[model samples]
Target: MERKKNISMAVIRRLPKYNRYLKELLRTDVDRISSKELGERIGFTASQIRQDLNCFGDFGQQGYGYNVKELLNEINGILGLAKEYKMIIIGAGNIGQAIANYTNFERLAFNLAGIFDVNPKLIGLKIRDVEVKDIDELAGFLKATPIDIGVICVSENSAQTVCDMMVSNGVKGIWNFAPVDLEVPKEIIVENVHLSESLLTLSCLMNDRTYS
Candidate 1:
């Protein structure tokens, strides 16, 4: 049966978990895995896993299950991680530097093209071998170089301004780490990451014994 397209995001979000389980199975030299077995490894119901996979069309046999390597490639293509994404970071503060140094970016097909900062002191500095250029050079740099995404890690006060600059320079997607919400045009995709709220949720989960 064809799955409804309305719940695409929910299915999309589960791909990473499925990929992780598949990777483990591959490491163990498992050639094929039943939906029930895959779900057991990832804490999901077999039916749910089957339904999610059905959204991308059937890949499993009636009783044999799915091919581990084939499923991995399918999920990678679905998540759009099959190709590398060129990205740049705006702001050279701790968060930005951490992102520049993060090894997960390369694993997830995100390449840190460069870093930008408004502070004269931070400008010309190097983080993870990527030089921090002045914010004023954003447009010119973008014009000459190819970057699809931007990571905004500026302070709350300067967040919107920096976002505006990034948008003006033709950044399609933005990973915003600022506390304040930004007002951007409809064409730009902005993803907000609230560190404090995430910590608060983790603290609450840790303190609460009833959370399943």
Candidate 2:
């Protein structure tokens, strides 16, 4: 089924959870599951699941429900995970190095093309076989090798400067971890991962919870 345009961001966000749960079903050798059952496992209402999937396309059958493997493949296609994405990391700090070390990045087809940092100590250090390079070399590296995604893990002060370098060098996607909103061309896509904000969200949820 073809993905429909203008799908709500809320629906788009739920797709990954569906994908993850479907993969788990595959691992368990579950061949098929009704929307009710799948929703039970995922903690969503069956009708909500049906509505979300319908936004993408017509899926499943009247009675037999969804085929686990086939649905997963379809969702993967929708999420643009079928191809490889060449990525570079800037900062090489704790957050940067942790991202570089994560095996799931490669598993998810995000290839770490290079890592860069300004500190002399981190330059030449290797993480997951990719040696850290001087930040000065970023422009040339981006020129030589086309990078699809640029990771910004530098401090807020340095984040915009690093983002500008990446954007000017033809990098289209930015995975920004630095705590600042970046200005980019309309065509450029930026996904921010603010650690502090996420932690605070958890705290807020905890505080808002009422005793049952």
Q: Which predicted model would earn the best lDDT?
A: 2
Q: Write the per-residue lDDT of candidate 2 for residues 91-161, one digit (tens) a residue.
A: 89899999999999899999999999999999999998999999999989999999999999999999999
What is the alpha-carbon lDDT of model 1 when measured against the actual structure? 0.87
83-102 in candidate 1: lDDT tens per residue? 98999998898898888999
Stretches of candidate 1 exceeding 4 Å from the true structure: 1-4, 206-212
Candidate 2: segments with Cα more than 4 A from true spot = 210-212
CA shift of 28, model 2, Å: 0.6
The local distance difference test score of model 2 is 0.94
Task: State in Å the error of residue 69, model 2.
Answer: 0.6
lDDT of 2 at 48: 99
